[model samples]
Target chain A: MARLSSENLETAYEIIARYPVKKSALIPLLHLAQEQDGWVTDVAMAHIAELVEVTPAEVIGTCTFYEMFKRKPVGKYVVNICTNISCQLLGGEELLHHAEQKLAIKAGATTADGLFTIEDVECIAACTEAPCLQVNYRYFHKITHGEFDSLIDDLKAGTRDEIPAHGTLAKVRQHIPAARRAGAVAPTDRAEPVWLIRNRQEGAS
Target chain B: MTMNDVPKIITSRFDQGDAHTLDGYRRTHGYEGLAAALEKTPQQVADEVKAASLLGRGGAGFPAGIKWTLAPANVWPRYLVVNGDESEPGTYKDRMLLERDPHQLIEGVLIACYAVGCGQAFLYIRGEMAHAQERMAAALNEAYAAGFVGKNILGTDFSVDVVLHWGAGAYIVGEETALIESLEGNRGMPRLKPPFFPAAKGLYMQPTIVNNVETLSNLPWIIRNGVDEWNKLGAETSKGTRVFAVSGHVNNPGVFEVEFGVTTFRDIIFDPKFAGGIRGGKALKAFIPGGASAPWFYEEHLDLPLEKVAIDRAGSMLGSGAIVVMDEDTDMVKAALRLVRFFARESCGKCTPCREGTTWMEKIMQRILDGHGRPEDVALLMDTADNISVDFMWPPRMTTICPLGQSATTPIASAVMRFKDEFERYVGGPIELNVTVKGAAFIGPPTRKKEGSGV
Candidate 1:
């Protein structure tokens, strides 16, 4: 029952224009769909399929393969805590338990109030600052139980201005001027570089 | 031991707060390398890099210069893909470079694009790194405004466009071929080689050169200072410095840029300048020489140098330059499980051996930690690991299409080989240990299809 807004449709068209091939924008459009609707609805996938000139089944194939795109609806803030080796060594497992208790939800469940979703994720590549977690993909490194509680409280109170909703990748949207584009096209009349020809000749001799 | 000072070439501006901006980057000898490179032909620029002998920093330390040449001659519209997908469990240096100093990366991209004759370049960053994506996107916009990227770069005859693409989370996309698949809006599964080598047949089935972020980041310095000056450091094989991210149990757990082939593991882990030794005066039990994929090295191998040949000869690779140290109190069985679980979860399900073998390994490791371990679980785990990796050897001979499948076995082989007693200690019954699998709801025993009730 979800659809991209007129503004988002324009944005999507602009994004597709950036790529040499239309199909290459499928992943980015899926992200845009998620951004517009929180989770990718069936309608949005079919819409994206139409946009990219691929079947809905093909869209599903690419969407399901990636871990970031949520197939089902999640809460506003998706708290992904790392429990891989580095974080595990630094009390990451205990931290997950603490988060579970605080949110009143298990690892893969959404809270009853629809405010938080907890996930025991793989490494977010912030190993140095072990025991790291991300709220809607914004990093809080080397977090403690107290710091985590305050973060939850802030998110619940809607006071954390920096952390946006789920699927919002960045604050700034990229806008490329048409003149600045690389104009990438399959070459038919390109000439061989002088250096390569020289190398080939030198080898022949 | 050569105790020469490790020069900070790529990361010289890391401490500067505003280095991500165009004006700030210009002040710090930033675009000077591009200017120096612009003075020469693309081939001459590539020749300079070959002379410097820069090795790729993304796990496999292949020569970056040689990789650029592998793209067939006159393969028009050959692409340059800059791999910012630093997803290896313990690695995080690329994130720092992307977040703190993006223009330096952009300059590196420009130099590479010009050298390789690519009309378009793709910078693929992993999705989990939101900050990195934002910083890079903003930096790319700044770069385009400054005429550093896009058509007619810097008022010269040369023109190229650099596109900043963020990947949806998939670890296998770190593989070059798989990355290309992901770029093409397909599942991030690796293609079979021989026909799909990125250099020969890549994006849109044209020749392509894929370089790591750190590898390309070295180009500016190499171009600006010349090869002889850049070659002053490092050893016979690895000819430059590398950023080693040290984490776990270490006092100063962070990224450090050190000259390659000079410092040893002992110096990196225990030295005051690096990780500053294990925390709380704890003794070192084991350490992953590279990221989670590399086999664990023990106390005996601490004296081995950080050289590629030295580490390779020592039966583990310095893959991804991520060093994770485990102290004496750390439970080896639990540690092994954590790594195997990562590989299993991120398997991508392209290869059956990888998809099933990693899961099998994880289940066994989980069972061992959960007080339900069978006596034959250790051998069973080893056999499963061997089936995936083909053997318990360094430079692993893999059964799957990519090294990811082989990566699952390193922890198993290393843990069982050295810490067999620890794994054995967890066997036979409900052993109450602090290392219990907390999130058991996610990974439980597979359900048996009730006594052959054919539906």
Candidate 2:
């Protein structure tokens, strides 16, 4: 197990302090541990248990409970494909097959080169873009078999930029076109009927 | 396309632009409810809420008024928690509200705090939703700056402060008690029920009211619209509109709102205006009425009214209203395997049943999918799921832990029950999976690519 530096430990403590209850820091602490060591280990779990004043069993229970936490070492990039109802109906199975065939490994298995691991995730909450995959926590939406293959090729060629660490909001904005962001009117904007819109204009008082 | 596209109830006020921003919200009578709420006594506010009969929109259909009344009276520093950790697989309604109309949620939080004598409130959001957290925090800052939140709210003696706390993104955090624990900086595992209900001993051991994001978001409207008016929109028992996240094989796969009893699955899915049924004339196989955790239904159940009671009566839940449809080509075994795999992976492992039970279920499903199933495995899977305990007792039941164990069994149980033939077919031979390409022939060998090898 990799030893977490004092800085990471302090950051964990700081995150716990921010919450009203120390236990709520379990997920954040695990994240911190992973951020520092790339994966959680038994030694780190023990240390987290001691720091949080919980039993080692409790820490282990938490680490194993959530799917996001890695019990074993993972590849540099994780591809989580959504095969839930929405995605499945939209040809998610084909996409998954394509992904497995392209990577030459089944879902939940890492590639031989240690570059990627593919996982079949449940709904990723991005059902709008059916057949989506989260490549290393960054979402790739509206994926097709051909598009996925090309994406892999781009990644292999180093043309696709490395996903930035702290630019998720920017990434989301980038995903949504500028026109949609600026001109996409919400439901509230047209609350009244069209007659009302015309009446208000005609009867400006 | 416009308000015309949205049903009247859940989105009566949706078309009002900038409803998230203070000025935009106020122009559409947003905080007017707060003023109305403050004018009356707390008991009166509670009574009005009780009269409205609003149920929690975050999966559990518990009444909001009942939750408020359950809180201990005269407790100092009582807490109001907004369960914004929308981790349910099919659910994304809370995320939409938080990201698009945060102030509405904040206003609802304020009203809820006022009704329950809560001075401090926390919005526990899912951590993976960095954008939502940022949007909510920005809204909180705007509300605080405008004196809508924090010390002497709206120039009244009654004060409330709202803070945004992010969950590490676990589905269990959506459970109220677990949500309380997560808010307190602990692991987001759920505690035993009965003694640990959030109302009695919650959030640093103070009386707390943990309401779903949509539930809280409804308070301001309920107060402003009056209970009588609110009751007019929906059925007698389940009053008000619900935001349904319609995804799956539908044409218009987005969030839609409808009155409680008015919208049926047929109207929501087949209507040209709404979801527009399965895309490209694909035959519907089944649909998950709620999130992935909820039990699934076959095509025959399409006519089942998409209501809380009706769906529950059909042995499924209206959980998070994340309608996930499946078409004819969908593989039930693989789908069930994928769903169970998520629960297994996310099982917080607090109790043996959930941790081990989920793992066992996943393994069995995987075995079946991999064409390595024995006949006994089917009965064994059912027995294992049935024997799995739901109670998480002190010293750690090792056998039980909240409903995580029970919830994990749902997809498997439902899939086996509904699609028994599919599972049986895999046992006889090497399953020759079929793939149909719309405009192309069978592709060549699958492409092999390594991650981080530059595309």
Question: Which candidate leads the pack in lDDT?
Answer: 1
lDDT of 1 by residue, A1-205 (tens): 4777898999999888777778888888998999988888899999999999999999999999998999998999999999999999999999999999998889999998888999999989999999999998899999999999999998889899998899898776667778776565543426553334554476579
lDDT of 1 at B303: 76
TM-score against truth, every candidate = 0.93, 0.77
Number of the top candidate by TM-score? Answer: 1
Top DockQ hit: 1
TM-score of chain B of each: 0.93, 0.88
Regions of model 1 farther than 4 Å from truth: A187-205, B1-4, B429-455
Per-candidate Cα lDDT values, in order, are 0.85, 0.70
Kindly list the per-residue Cα lDDT of model 2 for residues B1-455, writing each as its tens digit. Answer: 23244335434445666666778877877788888987876667889998888888988789999988887654555678888888777676887787777888888888887777775677787766656666687776667777777666777666655656656557777788888766655567788876888888787776778898888888888888788878876666678888888787777787888777557777787887778888889888777778876766665556666666666655567878888887787788888877888788778778877788889988988898898997667766766666563221111123464766766776766666556678888776323222221110011111321210111
